[model samples]
Target: MDIAEVLTLADDLIFAKTGKHLDYVQDAILRGTLEDATYTQIAQELYSSPSHVRNVGSDLWKTLSKGLKKNITKNNFRAVLENSKIYNYQSAIVGENVTVGENVTVNHNFNVCPEKARSPKTPQNPEPTAKQPRIDLGDAPEISTFFDRKSELTTLENWILSRTRLITILGLSGIGKTALTLELIPQIQHEFDCIIWRSLRDAPPLASLQTDIIKFLSQQQETNPPNSPLSRGGEEIQPASPRRGEEIQPLSPPLSKGGLGGVIHHLRSQRCLIILDDVQTIFSSQQLAGNYKPGYENYGAFFKQIAESCHNSCIILISWEKPREIAALESHQKNCQTLQLNGLGESAREIFTEKGLSESEKWSELIDLYQGNPLWLNTVAAAIQDLFSGKVSEFLSYDSLVLGDLEYLLNKHFQRLSDSEKQVMSWLANQNKPVEISKKPALLELSPSEFLKAVESLRRRLLIEKVQKGDRTLFAVQRAIAEYLNS
Candidate 1:
């Protein structure tokens, strides 16, 4: 029988037996089984996760098996129904059915029929099957050598496995946001059925991104390849090759409905881990941090839905600054959280040692000067080795911290700040310790609202930090940022 006919008969049998109708996901699983589709294929079609589909299929078979009084599974479900004389039989027992309040029972004499009694029995102990996890890391940088994010990785893993839907990894550029995420994958890959990593380097339009992601989840190729581009910004960067023995299928045509709904459907259906790196690229560069660029405003809604919607998947955003929506959502939502990465502390020494810098009394001083940033320390370590024979004392003998390429990096961050934000940074640079908002009015000559706005802006940009002193909230710039501001 065709799929529709099978569904009709099965639905009737199921409802009669249990007084309940199969849900859409369950019906879809049944249809998929009739078509001989794999669980992954069924999940892709339903925009659900493969593991969820498998569970639904398993429950469906067990229900049918108990109801039909015969072993039924994905492999033999069609055969069992076909061989039961269900099409020609007119009665439940010899053709009679009994009904009770809101429930109907169909009795079939499977014990008398040798063919029905001798059907292949379902395996009680099924062999463990290796699952192939779909990984798509689009344009995420490769980490050649990673270090000292053990604690951070463990925290992130716990968050993901605990069903934290939205997580933001915030840090300065080259502070190992990408490295930490890359290192995090291997640790958490087993928990998820699919892992997707996309970079927002060129700031693609949110709609286009949604379409791309949905297509991937649906396991379909682009229908209008020449007419539609994968990414709206620069040339689309291809994802790396899948691990050996993993099959990487070609992109198929787009889904019928291409937008947030489709994406959410997949998320709800599957256990996926989606990583979006360089998320700051989608924000307006010259405006307040976290404000989306014109066309990308929809991203805020997308993220908000992913955080608020009931879904089993997790999305980790690696950004220089937290998105504005995230800042607001995380305040009220438990599943959404932000992790701000600070300097590597003693871990900075590893970068220096790897670069052949000798240990000295001034090593701690140097590390403190660079705020224990691995990239900053590595850059200065090479300079010290070249200019001072790798002597930490020689590097520390100078009254000022080494600027090197750090100035350029800081410039990129500074250039994105608004005038008010820059003003706050300038004021904080002159202070030795954190200052409270109450004290800013006299020094800045701005209104209370303006002052608070500027401080909030700086906080979002990650150019300043808030510390609690007594009952007051104080703000301070990091040493590296202060040094850059002074220079």
Candidate 2:
């Protein structure tokens, strides 16, 4: 009867009765009730009026009561549900007038009764349930609040289920890349034999990281080692490619060295899900995006090997920048893909509601203004609560954008741009509307090549907007970013 299970069961029952699933407000009310939250607290959390919450809760209880064939009230909801569950479990019938227990018998006779049907032989050894995978979430942050990402989670799950070996999730900071991936784990973790989440923020060398991961994966092999040469102090014998005229590349794995080859051997040994976070840390700052820092160049090779080597495991890289090889790999290999996370759409209204912001109608305007980034919306929502007394209309009345604390975040993104890219951003920031960039503008200081490169780089960083007007492509900077630069 935990909140998740209760909500799921309630939702299913309600759907069965009404032919419709529970709405957001109803879901919120049920969750709030489970936590013993007051109507006032629930109203404030949803930015709803107390009257509306009460009316909805009243109707919801009545619906549940009718559906469950029992009296259901807000105060006694938990007890009613528990009793209903127990009743249903005991009422289930395996056979007519038959009791199920030790040496149970059926009173009714069948027309054809085999020997086993008369006296079923019991199994001497019962099959055990499958064990959960070993998981090590190193330094992974806990998600305090989660917004809806059902579509994103489904897409990621489909990719993993299809046996794609390498996935890189790219997004602007605060766009919920980590949150989305963390949410994805539960949906897809059952497909993996082991799951490991590690952060690359400290820029661990490729060899060291490889060794660390290999050490962890080797344990799965130790517990369930195959009767092959691998565990007999010898090299593994790889299976031959199917005779379908498809060429297969052979691998020469060196288990002794802490290198890509060794990592591939362990990856091939089991179905593991390895997540490397903060991948942008390994790239150099003040340079074009995704250029590796000095002495970190080997990571490019490691990534290439993970994508190219034949293995059953998946490696997910989370970062703010897309690595250079990703595009080429995606075009060349079916198992390699990149997902660039972006701002939310209508779903973002939930953030304002959670922050107790007023004027629900104006939320879309505010979400659009902040580009629908979850963290950015949360940040701006707090600002709206503090400066405008939670009035969205008043915040929008100012016309000009405000970046009270968002400036620091913008600074981080701008600092990563090269000189040419910064110039392009400055130009874009000064423009009042989205501009056509199909042709090089005379106003920009850079040459044609430099301008195009900068524009491409800015697009990759997700710092600029891309729009279409008739037959032309237009680009524009977000109002907040422009305000930051102007300030």
Cα lDDT of model 2 overall? 0.74
Tell me the tens digit of each residue's lDDT in model 1 across 1-487. Answer: 6554566566555555554455446666887787789999887765555776676688778888876778898999878977765563222221122222122223463222223332254112122122335678867877886778888988898887567899999998878889998988887775565688888888889888888788666651343232122221222313223444555332222378678877877776556788998899988877778888888889999999999887668999999888888877887556798899888877677777777878655678888787777788888888999998888787777786668788998999988887778777899998999877775557676777777888887777778888997888888888878988998
lDDT of 2 by residue, 1-487 (tens): 5665566557655654554455545766888898898888876654455766677788789888876667788889888866544322211112233333453332211111222443344222222122245678976998887778788888888898667889999898899999999989887875566788999989998878988887776653344343222222122323322334443332223445456767776666456799999999998887877789999998988888888876668999999888877777897556798888878999999888889999998999988888898988999999999999999988888867877789888888888889988888888899989997767778777899989988887887778879988988899988888898888
Question: What's every prediction's RMSD, in angstroms?
Answer: 14.3, 18.8
| Cα lDDT, model 2, residue 146 | 74
Query: What local distance difference test score does each model get?
Result: 0.72, 0.74
Any runs in candidate 1 off by more than 4 Å, and if so which? 1-129, 220-254, 470-472
Native RMSD of candidate 1 (Å): 14.3
TM-score list, all predictions: 0.69, 0.68
Taking all chains together, the TM-score of candidate 1 against the true structure is 0.69
